[model samples]
Each structure stands twice: as C-alpha cells, then as structure tokens.
Target: MTSSIVFDPLLPWPLLAVLAVIAALGVLLALWRGLPGWLLRALAAVVLVGALAQPSFQTEDRAPLSDIVLMLVDQSASQTLADRATDTEDAAQALAARIVARPNTELRRVDIGDGEDNTGTLAMAALNAALAEEPRARVAGIFMVSDGRVHDMLQAPDLPAPLHLLHTGRQGDWDRRLIVKSAPAFAILGEPVTLILRVEDDGAAPGDTLSEMRISIDGDTPQSFDVPIGEDIEIPVTLPHGGLNVIQFTLPEAAGELTDRNNTALVQINGVRDRLRVLLVSGEPHAGGRTWRNLLKSDSSVDLVHFTILRPPEKQDGVPVTELSLIAFPTRELFLEKIEDFDLIIFDRYKRRGILPAIYLDNVRNYVEQGGAVLIAAGPDFASADSIYRSPLSAILPAEPTARVIEEAFRPKVTDLGHRHPVTADLLGQETWGRWMRQIEVDPLEGEVVMTGVDDKPLLILDRVGEGRVAMMASDHAWLWSRGFEGGGPQLELLRRLAHWMMKEPELEEEALWAEPTGQTMRIIRRTLGDSVGQVTVTRPDGTEDQVQLEEVAPGRFEAVYEGPEIGLYRLAEGDQSAVVGLGPASPKEFEETIATGDALQPLIDSKRGGVVALQDGLPSIREVRDGRPAAGRGWLGITPRDAFETLDVTKTPLLPAWLVLLLASAMIVGAWLREGRS
Candidate 1:
C-alpha cells in the first residue's frame, strides 16, 4: 500500500485562482486600515479557500511487477561450428539461474535460429520481437549469447536498457572459403567463357600459401591446378553440351580450419548454340518452296543452305545447260564432307533424282543415325515411284507412304499423343486449324503420330533412332494456313517447334525431369509421352533419398513443389531420365564466416553503454544499477531495476471537512463584526 497528497478541487482551477487573488487584496486593505479582528478575517478566508481546494490523503493497494530481462540466444547454422553451440548453451543456463535467483526479476528467453530463407543469423530481429511483447518500462536489460554475426543490424530497436553481448567463439579460430566474384548466366556452346574467382581466408590467415583448386563439370572427374591464395584467378571454360551446365570449383581444405562447407562453389550456366546451321534440299520447285525459304531466312539465328532442283538431269530442255540459271547441287560436299557440322537437315517435297545418287542417300541415313537430326516435308511425289523412300534412307524414315495421294480439302487435327508431346502440345488454336488441299497417305512404322489428316490418317510423325531424332510431315499444303486461305492457325509455331525438337533441344524432349528453385522451395517438373508417371525419387547432397508423388497439371506434364530442409545440390530421377539442380548456394551465408567475433555487434552494444565478454573466459555475474549509470564492467553485466507497481484500488480522505470549515468561518466572521462595531 502507498499514500500520497492529491487534490479534488470543488470548482474549476481558473475560477479558484481569481477568488484567491480577490481575498489577498481584501486582507491587504484591512491591514492598512488598522482594522480590528483583521487576523480573524484572514484566518477565515484561508480556511474557506483550503476547503474549496479539497486536498485529500490518497492510499493505493499496490502489487509489484517483476522486471523482464530479454535474453536473445543465437542457434543459427554458423553457431554449430566448433564448440560454439555448447558454449552458448552453458552460458545461457548459468545466466537464467542467476536472473531467477534475483528478487522481482523474470527472464524472457528468446531462441533465435536460421532465418525464413537462407539468410544468415537474424539476432536483431528476434530481439525486436521479444521487446515488442513485454512492457517497455518493465524491460530491465538485454543479454545476447551469439557469435555476433548478425545480418540485419538496421532493424535494431532503440534500447530500453543496456544491451550486452556474450561472444561465443575463441580468438584464434580461422576459416577459408571460395567466392565466385563474377560469372555469366549463359554462354555460347563450344566457346570459351571467362570466370573470375577468389579464395579468401578470414581470421588468422597464413602468411604465404599455394592451394590446389579443382574444377569439374556435371560430376565429371576433377582437374586440379595450383593457385596463389588471396588473389583473383581467371578461368576459361567451354561448355560440353547445349543445355544447362553445372560447373563446380573447389579448393583443398586447410589445417586448423573452422569448417569446409565454404570450400566448394557451384555455378549453373545455360549453353546456347551461336548459330543453327540448317541444310534445306528441295527436289523440285513448288508453290510452298518460297514459304520454307522465307521462314528460315527470317530468323537471324538460322544459317540456311537452300538448294532447289529447277531442272532434272534427264529432262531435255530446248535451252542449253550453259544458258540455264541453275547451279549444280552440292550433294557430295553436304552429305559426306561436312554432314555432322549441320544441326538439322530438311528435305522439302524431295523426290528421288539423278542429281543425288544412291551412295549419297545412304550417307544421309548414316548421318541421321549418328546423333544428327532430319526433317522430311513430303508432297504428292512421295506416293510415286520416284519417292526418296525407295533409297537406303527408308531404313530410318518414321513412316512408309502408300501408292495413293489424297487431294481433298481437310482440316488438320492434333492426335491424342500430340496434346502431351512438348513439340505439339498446347499449340495455339490447335482445335481450329486451316484446311490443307493435299496429303500423302502413309502408315507409321516406327514413331508416334502427332497430327492426323483425312479419315484420321497420319499427317505428322516423330521418332528417335540410335542417338539421333527424325520428324516427318506428310502434308504439303500447311503453307495454306500462312496464306490465310481460311482462318489462319499456328502454322509458324508448329513448324518452329518441330524444327527445334529435331535438333534435340532439352525443352522439347518427350521424357524429361527438371526442377526450378525459388529461395528454399523447388518446383519439380516431369514431361513424358506416357499417360501416367511414377513417383520421383530425390537424392540430396548428403545422399539422403525421398520419394515425392506428382500431380498431373496437363495431359503429359506432372509437377510437385517441395521445400528443402537444407541448402545444397539435389538430384531427381523418374524412370530413365534424371536431373540435378542446386538450391540456395554451394555455401550458405551463415557458413561464410564460421569463426565468431563480436565486431558486428560491438557498435550496437556501445550505443547503449554496454560491454561484450567472451564465454571462453567465463560467464559474467548479473548486477542491478540505476538507469543512467554504467551497466557493464570487466566481469559483470547489469540490469536496471524498474521499481514498477500496479495499483488495485484507491481511497481518498479530504484534509478539511465541509462542516468543520463552515463552523470556523462563521465564528471568525461574527468576531470580526463585533470588534469592528465597538471600534
């Protein structure tokens, strides 16, 4: 309980001030006039004013509130290095015991770990959250047990009391980490790209040292080379394939190092072809010949080599050969000499001609079987005896043509498999395709049918032979859609995808598995030609396996989202196709500086008149001090006593009762009047 003098005035303060001033003036006049009983009148006026003031003795039923000391404990990934975790736990327990032993003091323990993402230690954020919960007046001080490697210092809250840090690690600790200073996201295939990297040592670095740096691509055998420490080295790397390339750079571990987590770094880059070399051979001139030429020529990335047979060798024209404006086809050079150099080979409405002998056709078939791509666009001539199928190339062709050619207006339709195949899947406006006037009747012998013509006959077929791929289009009137003969469709899109698929682009693969990472979450995707897919088994960097089921989002596509527990490389496999993806970084931010120091948090502690002590020395004793006094010493941390109380009830007793004041005032007046009348 507590007691104090408080006032409950009977009237407004302004009015009371005016009345007091008037009474003072009246007393002065009475004194000047030598008035009898003037003392009594002054006393009566004092008693009346005191009663109106209504001063009272107020008593409160009080309850003392315990002071709160916020303790922020860091348990982030970095704290796990060496004996930091054990040291922190020991110090925290000792501090808790001391605080609990103090009278009217409570400990608010806030355990801080890794951040929401891969961000390093967030000790300041945890401190702010803990402070927000408790009353500011009751917060005595803040105590932190950490390595002092805080990432968010700008969010530090204004201190209500002294802030002290108990540093966790020893002074002689050291670590070495690899840093990729600069790298490109994409590089042209078969071309050397430069990468800048550095090997850095933090805390107690050796004076002079040479380290062996090992490099690898896609889990290949590592190649090692000696590099000087504490300097940037430029490395020239050439990608092996045309897709996502994973390159890893690592340095050998050093003696007495804190950790090897930051020794290796991985960089992912996409490999793209500088130019697409396409060999286009047309057997004869047709209305759609210019369409193919125009499409290939429009793309700046394509290098088109077009040849048209305007005159057959057997045709007897009236004009001499010298006058004819036609050059001899380069079949020998293209089919044998530089066949593998071309990315794709296209035969537009081609037929068996004397220009290309049987030996040249056999070489073309061999080219397609040895990791080369071929696309055949057939016309009515495919059904005749002059068809290229009569040559040795028929062995690899996806379809065999019948002797009949259908010349009717029929709209092209996508087959059920086409809806799932990446090359034809989700083609714009596929349901409403323009009509084609001519198509060669064919039976698929070795590939999947993606598009059909009249009476559900195969119009487009795709297949993989040996190590190469092949695509065949049976209709010649596909250009009619580009001419807007009826409502135009995605003719250009369909042809572009078909060409890319033939080039074995990874995105157009029939069966593929890959993952995309956003922060710590990964979206695993599976593309297949089959209706149903099995569960994907994931292998983490630590060699742990997890089986995840996939949900069908489209006809041939399945996907699942997974949040990784740690940061590192992850391998995914479904059936025969497998992919590897890296999440976060090869080295997380927390491990960048494993050796702990108080340099990061010293300024924050100094701002609040606090000190930092290492737990290696010993845990400090807790002490109570005034708010503005020094709160930290060589071996002690301090907390300010709030002396806070909560009031349960209040009782008021007026100093001067109304009845007593009235009786005293009346007697004083009567005496003043009687004395003045006698004088």
Candidate 2:
C-alpha cells in the first residue's frame, strides 16, 4: 500500500492564481503602511483560497510481478554430436533451478529441435514463438544453449532484454566433410562424366596432409585414392549401362573428428545412350516402307539401316543380275556379325523369300534370345505358307499366323491389358485411331495382346524371350493412318513409345520398381502387366527391411508413399525387380559444421549488451543488472528487473475538509477587525 497527496481543485487553476495575487497585495500594503491588522487579513484570505483548493490522499494496493527469463535449449541434430547433448541438458537444468530459486524471477524454458523444410537449426524462430506467448514488459533476459550453428540468424527478432548463449561442444572439436561441389544430373553412357568435389577439415584440424578417399559404383568394391586436403578434385566416372547409376564416394574417418555422417556422399546420375541403332528389314518394296523410314529417320537420335528386296532369285528379268540396280543384301554382316550393335530389328511384310538362308533366320532367333529386340509388321504374306512365322525364327515370334488374312476395314482398339501395359498404357488418340484395310489373322501362343482388329482379333502382341523382347503388329495398312485416312492418329508418338519400350528403356519397363524422392518422403511405384502385385520390401541404409503395401491407383499400377526417418540410400524391391534411390542429401546441413561456436549470433548478443559462455567451462551464476549495461561477465550471466506491478485496488481520502477551512478563515477575519479597531 502506497499513499500520496492529490489535488481536486473546486475552481480552475487560473481563478485560484488571481485570488492568491490579491492576498499577496494585501500583505504588501500592511508592510508598507505599518498596519498590524493587514497581516491578519492576509492570513484569512490565504486560508479562504486554500479551502477552495481540495487536497486528497490516494492509496493503491499493488502486486509485484516476477521478471521473465527466456531459456532456449538447442536439441537440434547438430547438438546430438559428441557430448554436446549431455552438456546442453545439464546447463539447461542448472539454469532452470537457479532461476526458480531466485526471488521475483520466472524461467520460460523452450526446447528447440530440428527445423522444418530442411532448414538447419531455427533457434531464433523458437525463441520468437516463446516471447510472443509471454508479457514483454516482464521479459528480463534471453539465454540459449546450443552449438551456435543456427541457420536462421537473420530472422532473429528484436530483443527486449539481454541475449546470451551457453555454447556447447569442445575447444579441440574437429570435423572432416565431403562436399560435392558440382555433379551432373545426366551423362552419356560409355563416356566419362566429371564430378567436382572437395574434402576439407574444420576447427582444430590434425594435419594438412592428403586424405585417402574411396569411390564405388552400384555397390561395387570401392577403389581408394589420395586426395589433397582443402582442394577441389575432379573425378571422371564412366557409366556401364544406359540407366540410373548410383555412385558412392567416401573419406575414411580421421581420429578426433566430430562425425562420419559427412564423410560419405551418394550421387545418382542418369546414363543415356548416344544414339539408337535400328535394323529395318523389308521383305519387298511397299507403300509402308517409306513410312518406317520416315519415322526412324525423323529422330536425330536414331541410326536406321534399311534393306528392300526388289526381286527374288527365282524371278528372272531380261537384265542380268549384275546389270540390275539392286545391290546384294549384307545378310552376313547385319544378321551374324553385328547383330548385337542394333538396338531394335523391324521386319515389315517380311516373308520366306529365300534371300535370307535358313541359318541366317536361326541367327536372328538367337539374337532375340541374347538380349535383342524384334518387331514384326505382318501383311497378306504373313497368312500364306511362306510367312516368316514359319521360318526358323518362329520359335521366338510372339504369334503364329493362321493362314487366314482378314480384308475388311476395322479400327484398331486397345485391349484391357493394353491399359495396364506400359507400352500401350495411356496411348495418345487411342480411342479415335484410324482403320486399317488389311490385318493378317494369327493365334497368340504366348504374350500379351494389347490391340485388337476386326472381329476382335489380336492386332498387336508383345512378349519376352530369354533376355529379349518381341512385338508383333498384324496389320500392314497402318500407313493409311499416317496419310490421314480417317483423321490421323498419334502414330508418331505411339511408334516412338513402342520403339523405346522394345529397346528396354528403364522408364518404359512393364514390370518396374522405382522411388521418387521429394525432400524426406519417397513415393514408391510398381508397374506390372498382371492384375495384381505383391507388397514391396524396402531396405533402408541401416539394413532394416519393411514391407509396404501399395494401393492400386490405375490398372496394374500400384503406389505408396514413405517418409524416410533418416537420410541415406534406400533400396526398394518387388518380386525380382529392384531399385536404389537416395533421399535428402548425402551430408545433411546439420552435420555440415559440428563444432559449437557463437560467431553466428555474437553480433545479436552484443547489440543487447549480452555475452556468450561455454558450458564446458561451468554453469554461470545468474545475477541482476540495469538495462543498457553489460548483462554478462566472467562466470556470470545477468537479468534486468522490470520492477513491474499490477494494481488491485485504490482509495482516495480528502486531506483537508472544506468546512474546517471555512471556519478557521471566519475566526481570523473577526480577530483582524477587532485588532484594527483597537489600533
């Protein structure tokens, strides 16, 4: 309770000043004229004026509020290194106990961990949130226990009080980090691609010598080499296959280092072929021959080898064989010598014309079984006895001709299976494709029928033999669609997808298992031609396996999303198909710099007249200081007292009552009159 005199004047202050002036004039007249009663009259006037000015005593009951001290504890990934976690916990508990024991003080404990969206340690954000929840006037000081590796120092809020840091980590803490300075997302297969990297030491490094680094491809045995410390080195890597290549680079752990998480780096580079080589064998010259040539030649990435048999050996013309314009077909070179060089082999209206010997046909069959691709476009000859399906290559063909040729116009339609097969799934303009005039009838002995012709007959069949793939197209009048026979279809795109699928492009595989990583989450997808697929077994970098069920979103397509608990390599396998992918980064931002220092936040601390002390030394003693003064010193941290209070009740009592002042003035007036009369 506190009391003070307060005025409640009956008249305006200007009016009271005029009354006071009259009283002073009276006193001056009495002094000048030697009148003894003048002093008494002046005293009465002063008492009258005082009665008009009311004075009251005001009392208030207030409760003092405790000063708030914000203590932010860093529990981020970096703080987990070495003994920093233990030190941070110990410092936080000790500080909390000290603040609680201090009179008129409150501790606002805030535990801050890893930040969202891969932003390292957002200690400032956590601190701001805690401050917003408390009364700003009562905030005394701000304290943090961390390694000083905050990534969001620029977002630090304006301090209402002193800010200090109780730093974690040790003096001689060192760390060796592998930094991939530059890496390409794509590289041509069979060619060397360069990856620029750097190896450097931080803190109190042991030596300035070369370090031995090991590199491996697709989990192969790692090869070790020496790399100069603190220098960027260029590593040239050649991909073995035309697909995604996983390369791992690691540096052997040095003694007295912070962690080994930053020692290994995983790089995923897509390998692509330089060009696609295609072998197109046309049994005879036809209108569709140019169409095949046009499609293959239009793509700059394709190298086409075309052969057209203008005449057979049985056909004798007036001109001799040497005089004819047709050149000898290179059957030996193309079919036997360099068969593996071709990525795809297309047979357009090919028949048993005796031009290719039986042994050559057998070699073509062997080619398909040895990881080759073949596409057969059949015509009327396919239904005849001389059909190529009747040759030695028939064993590898997907279908057998029934010796019946359908000669009616019918639109090609995708079967139910086609909607699921990657080769024909979601084909452009598939529902509005033009009609073909002729389609050779055939029976599918093995493989998937993707498209149907007239009477629901198989128009397209796709199959796999040994390590190769085969696709059979039963119509020769597909060229009509190219000429806009009924509104041109997506022929170009359809043929392009077919060629790529046949060539075993990883993206076009019917049965594929792959993962798409976005941040720390990976969406695992499995595509198959079958109606159903089994659960995918995921093996994390720690060699722990988990079976995740996939929900079918479309026909024969199953998918599931997984949030990775840690950063590193993850392997996904479904049946015999498997894929390896990397989530997040090889070296996370938290582990980039593990040594604890307050250099990042020193400026902010200094601006608020605060200081930083290492927990390794000892817990600092808490003290109180004035605002704008140094709030921290050797072995001590200080807080400022706000001296704030909340008023509960107030009372006002009149210091001098009006009646008593009036009575006193009247008595003095009467006494002055009697004195004047006597004088």
Question: Highest lDDT, which number?
Answer: 2
| Residue lDDT tens for model 2, 332-439 | 998889988999999999989788889988988899999999999999988898889888989998898889988898988889999898878887776678878899
Tell me, by TM-score, which candidate is best: 1
- Global lDDT of each model? 0.88, 0.89
Q: For residues 1-679, what per-residue lDDT tens digits would candidate 1 score against the true structure?
A: 9899998889898998888888888988999999987898898898888888999999999999999998889999888988998999999999989998998999999999998666788888888888889999999999999998999898988899899999898878888888899999999998999999988888887754778899988767899999878899999999998788888888878888888888888899999989999999988888788888888888898999999887786788688868877777777888889888998999999988777889988888898889898888999888889998899989999999997899898988888999999988998776577789998999899999999989999999999988898889998888897898778778788888998888887888889998988776799999998988999999887899999999999999999998887666778889998887777775688987777777888788887788889898898888888988888998899889998888899999988888888899999989999999999
Candidate 2 residue runs with Cα over 4 Å from true position: 1-65, 279-300, 303-341, 350-369, 384-395, 427-434, 479-490, 531-535, 550-553, 644-679
- TM-scores, all candidates, are 0.82, 0.78
Candidates in order: C-alpha RMSD to true structure: 5.0, 7.6
After TM-score superposition, the amount by which residue 252's alpha carbon in candidate 1 deviates from its true location, in angstroms, is: 2.9
Q: What TM-score would you give candidate 1 relative to the actual structure? A: 0.82
